[model samples]
Target chain A: MSLKRVGNQTVVFAKPPVILSSYSIVGPKEGQGPLGKTFDKVWKDALNGEKSWEVAESKMLQEAMNGAINQASVPKEQIDFMLAGDLLNQIISSNFAARQMALPFIGLYGACSTMALGIAVGSMLIDGGFAQKVLVGVSSHHDTAERQYRLPTEQGAQRAMSAQWTVTGAGSVLLGSDGAGPRVTSATIGRVIDFAVKDVNNMGAAMAPAVADTILNHFHDRQLRPVDYNLIASGDLGAVGLALACELLKQSGMNMGTNFTDCGVMIYDESQDTHSGASGCGCSSVVLAGDILQRIKAGKLKRVMLVGSGALHSPTSALQGESIPGIGHAVVIEG
Target chain B: MADQTQKKPLLSVTAEKYQTLIKQYTPKPTIIKNVVRAFIVGGIICSIGQIFINLFSSFGLARVEASTAATATMIFLGALLTGLGVYDEIGKFGGAGSIVPVTGFANSIVAPAMEFKREGYVMGVGAKLFTVAGPVLVYGITTSIVVGFVYFLLH
Candidate 1:
């Protein structure tokens, strides 16, 4: 079985999979952000009437997934697979949502990059003829991520200037071979690149190198220049990381001018006090499902490259003196 | 944690470049504003403690007793404010000023416990109760004991 491999690290789908439907739901805080109006649903309560924030995250994913399936007008039984994840221990949010939905599920954990991984795999499944229609979703709640990744908000802890606020939202995209929407044309799987950045507070620094590496690889593999795509977007590499990524890409002899932007940088208003910018799995997911796809459909962007970046570090790993390793997966979407 | 030196063989140059870029892009806090806020907030908290001391002293309490009463009262106020979720707001605006008070200590303990209350009392609230303020208490008690021992020896 010879897969249609690009130059290296990328797979080109002969028959690209179409994104049939997509739904985005954000919490009160994220609902008030720049992309607030673009989302399909915005919950008034961050807790979503749940007991704990973790459970609330699961609820968001459940709603987003159901909403996507409904928007696609596909029966639950007809959906062959569900690929989902979140920023939680064991990805409890996606797992819990899977239990509620009872769909054939594959749980993923790519830190903030879970959405890209899900869409990439879902696209592959559809393009390879394994499934006719697949569901891919990812979510992250600020409260849940705050407690798990750092100190609880109630602790009144001060965040570093480099720290990024985890986004409170969920986004789900339905992909099928037969639908009419922006198509997933190619995917570039990333390799773990550790630059020995150990500061848990500075996630942008930790993840920027991987974003640059993957983007460069995507360009090399597809034999495309920055001018080929109308937009080159990165997942959750906030203001700092976006700057670093742009510089790194430029040093490697590729120029990404105004075409380059980041989900982290665009999601929040500057006055929102999200030190660097917004992050988490939901950051890129909501932006892609809610804003970018809409722009593409409106004939604003013809081709776009979405690079999902993740800092693959645990608290235990950081405490044990391990340098944080990062990964960035890129998926090409053509309108 | 700071002792660990970053020494990736192949990517060291890239790391150096990234560090420079991060320093350039990361926002620096307004020091004057933060210092002024901290000073005002800290001074206000201390003044409230002084008021408690004066009230106790007026009620005919001895100097040491008055100080003790004021500290206890301040601690109570801090714990109350933390429980009501008001101290966190103060903390956001006041920074170290809010944290330097007895109330900040109360906020530290109650905040984690309250957030983790969903995990259950034993592992969640109970274990996490002392996480933020534990080191402060440990060092404070240890330093006092050392000082007491030195004074006893000198006397």
Candidate 2:
């Protein structure tokens, strides 16, 4: 109960909640990536047996949550809360999956940053003694996201170099008050920063400023240097946003060094033809659940900072010539 | 145009400023490559149509009937390719070349319908079947009717 608030936008947990278990389900493309073997399940079919891509996303989340909960050895009713989100309009994938799961759901919409946002909130709930166990989930389907946010897959529109392909996958993490695993140690909530960037295709460019802002704030609030963490990961800046964020950070006299990387750039191989790289809510979610957590358990990484960034522009707003606003939330996970 | 310019100097200034800023980041289209791809694809599609027309005419059909049969055959091929998920690939490679043809019209109708087929037969497939191609059909039919009416009146 002692002061958890730190600096302007950070919260340091007095008692870090343990991540009991994590599960990730990815599509064929992601399954073909470097960390493909680490995922609990990879659907070879993009549709994943569902009739539509949206429904396929819902099913992916449902299966991910079920798998994570089962892996954690916790029954569904025992889990106190379920926090989840997706990129679809009204976040229908999460809502529909929650309906099927029948858990007490707190639906969220952080665009691509939903994973980190959910984990941060879940950590707070458990640390605050309001919940003994919490489930955090996030998902994004490339087709569904394209249909809602951009052009349909049917359109076959040529993507610009800065455009990122949304990752088709889902990931779930189960956090508990008492568990023997990596712990959620702190969180930094990001502010919405818009520098009047109105291009919908160049989301990495739109979100880079916000990532830099949150990372700087998180570092200052936590009084930690970049060398303190084994690795620092961004949500979905890809090639373009990562460079911009690093430049911005360098301007602030902070250097992340060789430890810095982005989930978007890591999830897809360059030959995959993802213009910038893999993006979406599922990018960081599955990466954290599958790659980061596994590495931590294997004694390779002791500390990691995951900064999830999201563009908050809607299609309607973009069409109306409104600038794209972006957010980034940071979570510190320690082994 | 002169009166508007005289009345709205501030509007012009703002428009110019916005235009300059947008131009900096706007992606430059590869015009030559696109034009060449479009021309080649369009020519190939038209040549196929011509072959179909010649074939039908050699079977003793009239010229108009042969042309109509060729158009129907092209549309049928387009719809079949769309169903088999090949038209999208062609469209991806050919860009406007594929889209400017009657086959592309068939593709536009079938693509969304196939995508929405999972929602249900009536509300999903049937309704969305025309979502993409609806405007073209409406305007094309309407303009043809207008032209027909005008020709009749003149006669």
Candidate 3:
């Protein structure tokens, strides 16, 4: 019944919050990837002079957050809130970064979907007149993630062919109520979908259904088809997940066509030897912050939908033989 | 709660159907290729160990002592390679070949120790040194104990 509430699970902002500026900083590996030149800064080393990979990850997040804020030319004190998250236990990267930023921090834990979730929440804060400007950021590191989720960094275990390389990067976006940039017009918060995928290596397969569900909901709610957007990018669905998602969407009578692509697949090249593709919280965030927004600003892309997909399963849960639950959050950005 | 119970079975059915669809897209692991690579690499490693055994034997050590010294040497090499960050790449290429050897056992122990060393010596390396090798040791010793008991009863 509300004007903002759309068909089912979407919110159409009355006053869309504009993405004032965004900054992406990636490790050496990602900097060598296809979208390498698009990132704002590329660290020469993954450690970036930090003693530990965990510390490096937090530092990268801080650098990205500061870079975004500085690019927006907004005073630090004027920013209403900081929404940040990362692929780490207790979201230590974001929490540690927030400690230095000294802002009203809200640590999120949406795994890979943190970027879209943060943008959706930030837009709502602005559109609802609760905040003037908000900073949203997400980070993930390959070494740190591997240590926490899978095995030790130097462990000699052959990676599964379906396994994705966790992207070592951080991306931050600055949102303002009034700005001269692309606006976040609508959002579709997705339901957690578990297709009983137990293998952590096959994250793409685990997350495909969730992406399709969220995209379908977004289209239904917005009364817009796939053709309406110049690009509809899913977060970190990699090659396997993207293919499954396309097939699933087609079965639902929603043909995505050529306009649909995935951030994971786009980030790395086939020659990179990243079996499936790039993944992690940073995967979508960096792609969106670096490539997507830049294209929007350059007039190459108009309306875009970023559907961040996340495989929600802990190592403990996976060890317990529980199926991996997947989630996808959709944020529609219009130029 | 009532709604959840009613929807659970239906949800599971859909999930099952979706999994079948997922299988069509997921690529099968290259088992044959991996096995072949493993065989070649594992053979080369064992040959190197045999060479080490022969070298140690020429030094007047007994056959048993020579074999033991070769194993220790191989383990030391594995740990050294792991420290130098080369063993993981070898493991990647060799698959089970690199892992089935005594050197791989050393790698399993040394890798975690190196990774966790940052958390500090006492809690980090000391606690996690055997994280990957712990299961192997646990089951190996347990099975040996059981086998020993069986042998004693038979004797």
Candidate 4:
């Protein structure tokens, strides 16, 4: 009932309700290309041959949720809640995924930031003693995202350098009352900040305001500078957005260059030619699920500010001549 | 018997609707299962393609030409299958499997106009322009600006 209920405890009575345990996923950590080609491959692997982006995405979500549950050795029936979402309107991936898992659910839509948002809340539920076991998951498929959000790659259409490689993969974590893993220590929910750039398709610019807002919140709430974080990362800001974040951070009086980083800019290898870098829900998850969590588990990373960002634009909104809606969430995980 | 068959509507009509009418009915037509099939099929297709690429090398086809041929084959296969409606069936089943590749992108653009032709040119052909490509152009530019700016700052 009071703010004291959610204190900033590093060792907080904080049972994640369940251990983040282990995560499993499929992605293109090996090679990269144009966003569309990469996404096609992601869907190709994720959906197999499913032509429909929505269909493959739904299935990929199911696979990701299954990975969390199966890896945790938790049965579907035992789980109390499942929180998930994607970039699609109505979050078709999360919605359809919920259908397959047949678990109680909450559909989230924080863009690439969906994973961190779900993780932050799920961990809080465990920390707050609300639920004994919670499963938080998020995913995206390149093809599904492409059809829903952008071009079908075959047209050989050119993408701006700021465009991010929408990763085609799935990620999920099982959170519960176990304290053996990286504890969810503190979470700062970012309020929406608009830069007033209304070009709906141009999400990097649209989301900059939200990214700046959350990074500032993370610093303000923690009362610390960027040096405090071993790494301060943003979701799918890509190349342009990531650079913009640095400048924005400076304007906010915090220099994160010594530590600040971004998932979107990091996911791709140099070959990708990804102008901005990586975007979409799968970007953060793949990085987290693939290596970041492992490093944390190994005591390699002490503190990390993981933020996910998304452009909140609808197919019709872009058509209606409205600016993109941008939202971001920051989750601070400390060892 | 004929009238009864006509009245029944195959019950499968529900399958094509993308939504369910019955409240208590369970969610079926799992996309996950279909995705798995698509992966298997698409992988096989890719592997076969690789084999062709290798064969072309052995047979003296240059890399560029071989790659182009491979892409051409995929496009031809894509267009032909799309024309036959088989791609749509795959689209319904695997969703992304058939759609995620260069082929899926192909379908996103072409499928609409084919459906639209019945309505005449402006609505059909013109309408198809934005159906799939719109997201690409818009996100494409915005993402490019972000990427370019990032490169500018980071570099």
Whose DockQ is greatest here?
A: 3
Rank by DockQ (best first): 3, 1, 2, 4
True contacts kept of 4: 0.01
lDDT string, candidate 2, A1-335, tens digits? 35688777888888999999999999999999888998999998988676779889999999999999999899888999999999988999999999999989999999999999999999999999899999999999998987677654675345677788899999999999997999999999989877567878888878877888898888777678999999999999888788777866775678779999999999998888787787999999999999999999998999999999999999999989998998999999999
Worst 10 residues of 1 chain B by lDDT: B1-10
Q: Show model 4 residue runs off by greater than 4 Å.
A: A5-18, A27-46, B1-155
lDDT of 3 by residue, A256-331 (tens): 9999999999999998999999899999999999999999999999999999999999999999999999999999
Q: Could you tell me how far off, in angstroms, the CA of residue A118 lies in candidate 3 after the best superposition?
A: 0.4
> Candidate 3 overall Cα lDDT vs. reference?
0.93
Predicted complex 4: DockQ: 0.02
lDDT of 1 by residue, B1-155 (tens): 11124321122236667767767766786788889999999999999999999999999999999999999888888888878878888898899998988878888888888988898999989988888899999999999999999999999
Candidate 1 residue spans exceeding 4 A from truth: B1-13
DockQ of each: 0.29, 0.11, 0.43, 0.02
The window of 10 residues in a row where model 3 chain A has the poorest summed lDDT is: A1-10
Best model per TM-score: 3
Interface RMSD of each: 9.7, 14.6, 5.9, 25.7
Model 1 pairs in collision: none
Task: Report the Cα lDDT for candidate 2.
Answer: 0.87
